[model samples]
Target: MSPETTDLPLTLSADHYHRPAPEIPGAIALIEDAQVGVNLAMLQTGALQIAIDSQAVKPGDKLLVFIDEQLVLVSLVERPCNGEPIVRNIPAKCVPDGIISLSYRVNVEQSAPLKVLVKTELPGGVDPKPEAPGHFLLTPPQLTPTTLDGGQAETVRIAPYPGMRHNDVVMLKCGNWTLPHNVTAHEVGQPLTFTLSPEMVASNGDGAIVLYYTISDAVGNRATDHSLGLAVMIQTGSATPVAPTVSGVDQQNALYLSQLGSQTVTVSLDTRAFTAGDRFTLVWSGVDRTGGIKLFTQEQILERQTTLEFSVANNTIQELAGGSARLFFTRTDAKGGEQQLPSREILIVGNTRRVSATEASPQQAPGEFAAGGS
Candidate 1:
């Protein structure tokens, strides 16, 4: 007849004591070094077994397994005249997602937990690309000495992408720099955010840089997809801008919109280092005829040209009858490198009167058009 058997739980209890770790002895030992890839088909079939010490684990004793510190499996050990371990068929869904750990214990806590490496939840055909972000202007404080010393950080907002799960690890890479963020329970399926220090930006300030992000699920499965990229350039330091040449104004550098009629004020730049497909934006800012805040803007895309010309509408020119206004333009090169010119003060000596008339002839006086207070 078979000898009577004992019972115990893996957790600490009044009757249980710590035991040496279970041995995955013999051919079944391959389970100990399973830190490789997830065999989805095999896990679903429940063909795996837990090799145990026939002497240490008694009949009726409880066996337990955990992943990432979370309990996931529990089984009862039965006995007979056999050296084979109890084939514990753990369902695939029962395995908790984890990065680097999987452990088991019998009756009482084991001397140590086994290291298990399993990769699962790989994005076979799902989209892995993160949403692109709009361009951002770096504020003065962002480039201050505090930022350089790591005392300050620049915050970035990330729009939520499809299939985001809690505990997934997300990473952002720009040029030679990268940062990571862990997904929290409440942050799941919501817009995520991360930060980049000023030092990081300054290190990548050489030229236009492509930015992107990647995601790794909690199960150590890296998304099998390439992320979309956006190009941007960080600007710091200082550079003098060539004064903007304006046509359709009196000899006093004063604009008279009433006399100008339907004619527009043409602002031209001597395209320096300009190329086709380059984009230019012209902005006019100052007080309107009523002395209230006013702003006007225009955009132009260069095809193949020597000069960058941006025309100001007659109504826009007439609206700025507050004596003077500020005019400035920014150029974004084909490769995404951007250059901003300092604001140039222009005289607007015209009343709010709009009418149709002949166009004003071109006028140029490089020295007279010198940039003033911005």
Candidate 2:
């Protein structure tokens, strides 16, 4: 009833139609809603628009906004700047000739400073390589002999044992890190010799035999295994033996025995003066008292004095006619010296019996004289 009550149908798709305002036009813009459309006239006029629905713009996104009529652009609004929303502006006609490089500053905490490296690939497959730094290696020197006597003098030539040459130099290597050392010719031998300070010798002990030596090689290298070592030994004196003496009645009896029944014998010497290593000898000849020189006896005595004592006994004796016996004695020293005592001369007497004749004639004479007178 109002204007004949006739409603016209609206065509949704067409070449030209009414459209909403663009949320973002050429240049760049931040929008709260993205469901809006741009005017169809703006599209025909080469105007660009893009929709965005963001609480905050992200790193990569498109943004659009209108700067003026007949000018449109496409832009990309990356990250926020200065804590504010970012908008990148672009023209719609053609891309700008200048560079559109991006710059970003980020904060990263580090305990150490950052290191920078520039790598470049050379042509013809050539590449840069890291080089090693120069270094020094040290070695210990070697000595001809490792042992030396403390009693020797310094500055003597050094020579090793049997296999070593007479004039060969005993060298010590100056290692990469050490100094050179040398010894004189007299310093090396079966028992290498060297002069040691009195303080060093006394520290060990008086009259102690000490040995010392060091080893090295040519380079400046040093070795703990090749280091010097020392040894020491103390000296002592020799022992002596004690002398001995003879005593008591046995010694006297021995002397008396030597003097008995000996011919051309000498007096006995005292046994007390004898030393352990002394020696003695004796010789004797004796004749029995029976006037029988055919049965004469000869004797020899040999004596050695030692730490221990021993005795020899002879029981041989010859009996004479009258119950008398003859004996001989000889004495000897440890060194084979001999002496003999005089032979003993003993006397023996026989028992005697006496007989007397009776005088029968005397009685006869007295009787005869009386008869004759009658």
Candidate 3:
């Protein structure tokens, strides 16, 4: 039989035990299935994985790799030198030292480049900090007055400048008036519209009012720009009476009522100069055949332009002693005082003969002659 086999002594067989490799210096080794790029190299060994600069080794060279200060691999350099980085374009908006997905289309003449590294370098002596808005105004303020009544409130809207933020405040500086309003809605780089209602407006020694404004940020940094002036004229007291007249009648002193088979005679009352609650009356006075006084009157409240209609019936016309009458218009204001317009004479006529002789010649009342004969 072969020589009897026996177990070796532990001290004599020490060379066969497993142990960690010594530390390696000056070079790093590639791992199995390693990937090399233009500027980077990835290595994996044992339980450790790491990346290193691939340009450290020339092609066809061997290198020793260290893992945790121990020599774990010895790999040969098979990757070729990388071509110079060719970046066609950098990202449009890049903040210094901020991580950004660089945008670029690169082309290399040599073997395909491996990794990409983007560096955003600031110019020397330049800072990359954000800044507050600078003073800017596209155009001056254009103010439009809503009303000129001092007893009523007035509204003014201002178009804001570009680069305005919602945190900005608008300050209105009219005579003896200072209004502070905040911007509720505004986006960066966009214009804003601000509206304000002032309780009272100042009169410029006269009856005219003016307004202006300034703009400021939340921190109180204001724009030193000036705005155009807004002017308004406040009307006080009451409007003067423009005098009431009969519609379609040119002459102020005369009126004619023709017989349309006792149809209603309608005349437009111009009450434009009057307001609500004013009172007025139209008076018709004449003499009856028996020497009795014949008088007709209608009262009205002024609302707007009004229409007044009355009947000049045959019975009413026949009662006049001379078939003649006089009509007058009167208006009363806040006080009971009255304002009477010029009087108009009436001439009565029948189908065949003249019931009353014309007191005023036809030339004196041309509008009356045309109206009565029609």
Candidate 4:
């Protein structure tokens, strides 16, 4: 053998090229080893250079390499590619977003088919398992903000990946509603899209819609469960407006007596219009579990958009039992139009050493700072 032929590391066992003596005389059969492997497995660029293990190869023994599922014959040379493994890139047709395709160029000197594998690594998400070459379907990636506004036509796109072939069936389901009951993966480079009909809009008060899907190949191999589902939120219209009020308490309706403590509260002004110089009063009334009530009231004139914190003196925390409170707001507009909206309820619990007397005290004067106004 020339030095060029010696460059490839022999991958076949010494016994692979040897055959046992035939029990029957005139039948001199050349039994090739069933075991198969490749040397110089790494691709230089896009091309693969490999050697065959069979000794029966002739000077013109034809060799074939499998790229993807397609086969291309390679010219066998006494000195292949000038003794250097040539590189080859995967075809542009095989490259798709979020997909990693593995193409193997095997030595088909023997008659059996060789296997290739494809894998995927989705950033910040599950890595789909590699699958053998042939028919396969990939699971769609997770969709963000699974919710949608109702009473309108909407569209959502799922990330694309390998193993998704044209005409593959993609089934989508959302609570009692299944549109395009059977859709196909038809476009390349573009994400799979689903259209939500106006009829799909959620009605009947804040109803939730969840989207689930499954992908199947023509031969019916489905992507594993791990990669097959997603969820969506669907509504017919804007959520009902919540009245301008206090919401989200950092501390549950409770006061701690350790020190002059404060809890952050969210003043939700959902859709409540305000004009300049509006005067607002927040009245907090807590009723002890036994029906005894303690009241705290504060008033503030509007300045620009403001930041607010709710605080209570340690002495104040000492005066309440576990119960609930009602928040009443009185707003006076620039024209002296006073509006007393419906009161909202808040919970209150006392974490003091003991429950203080429930006797009502005069509403204290408002504080200098925006918070802690009595």
Highest lDDT against the true fold, candidate: 1
- The sequence of per-residue lDDT tens digits that candidate 4 reaches over residues 1-374 is 11112232223333542321111111112212211211111221222233333334444333333333333323343333443332322222232222121222123322323222221212112222222111124343344555555556667566665555543455554444444423344464457777766565443123332344545433233443212334344443465313334443323222222332454344443213665578777656655433356787677676664532244343433454333445555678888999754344433334412212232322211210111111
Cα RMSD to the true fold for all candidates = 25.4, 60.7, 39.3, 27.1
The regions of model 1 sitting more than 4 angstroms off are: 1-125, 128-154, 235-374
Top candidate when judged by TM-score against the true structure: 1
Per the 3 Å backbone cut-off, how many clashing residue pairs does candidate 3 have? Answer: 3
Q: Name the 10 consecutive residues with the lowest summed lDDT in model 2.
A: 127-136
Report the error of model 3 at residue 90, Å: 29
- How much does candidate 4 score in TM-score? 0.27
Q: What lDDT does the true structure give each of the candidates?
A: 0.50, 0.25, 0.36, 0.38
Cα deviation of 254, candidate 3, in Å: 55
lDDT of 2 by residue, 1-374 (tens): 01111132222233322222223343212211212222222233332223333334444433322222112322344454344433222222322211121111111100111111111111111111111000011111233332323343223222252222122223221110112234334544433333334334223222212121223211111111111212222221132211112221122112222323332223233444455444433222222222233233333332443223322222222222111222223345566674332222222111111111221221211101111111
Q: Give every collision pair in model 1.
A: 9-107, 35-117
TM-score of each: 0.35, 0.15, 0.25, 0.27
Give the per-residue lDDT digits (tens) of candidate 1, residues 149-235: 223566656666555667667666544465778888899767776677768866543333334455665544454332333434444
For model 3, residues 178-269, the per-residue Cα lDDT tens digits are 56667765444444444333344423111323344555543233343323334434443354223223332223221223423544444345
Error of 3 at 78 (Å): 55
